[model samples]
Target: MTTVPRSLDEIIASADALADRFEAYEPADADRDSVDPTTALWLAASRRAAAERDLAAAVVEARRAGVPWKVVGELVGTSGEAARQRYGRHAAR
Candidate 1:
């Protein structure tokens, strides 16, 4: 939850935690039969927020290790410029 993780290990740990939390919820058969739209929306939004946070943390770790933007972009399936534009400012702060 800090601006950036202090190390690659820390980033990985945080990501794992987020993923675990995101996956922890599962509706029972009865609950699934009558799903609450608000609850469903909250779950979806929470997962997305966790994913975005994890990605930003990973980007910071990569940049700290001197990984080039091109490599980062390739890994994430984006152009170097696009990746930088999206994550660079956050890393800078």
Candidate 2:
């Protein structure tokens, strides 16, 4: 069977689903099987890192397009100073 590639959001969602499943799981044979929580945690970390990178790239693009830090902050749901503090250096490059 051919497998389709999943987007970052989809991957994150799948990871969340797996976490929920694992959380509710009970092993019928404890000597034979186990559920690993680290997989979900790693997936969550990967998703967070990917999102941060994408946000930085968008910030750079917005700065290049002459978008104000205040506007960027509004779009990102933060104060202008906070947004600038977080992304100004990346946007500079």
List the candidate 2 regions with Cα displacement exceeding 4 Å.
1-35
Question: On a 0 to 1 TM-score scale, where does candidate 2 land against the true structure?
Answer: 0.62
TM-score per prediction, in order, is 0.63, 0.62
For residues 15-66, write the lDDT of model 1, one tens digit per residue: 9988998899787799767769998899899999999999999999999999
lDDT of 2 by residue, 1-93 (tens): 834438988788878988999999876797345447897689789999999999999999999999999999999999989999999999999
| Cα-based lDDT at residue 8, candidate 2 | 89
The candidate maximizing TM-score is 1
For candidate 2, give the lDDT: 0.90
User: Residue 47: error of model 2 in Å?
Assistant: 0.6
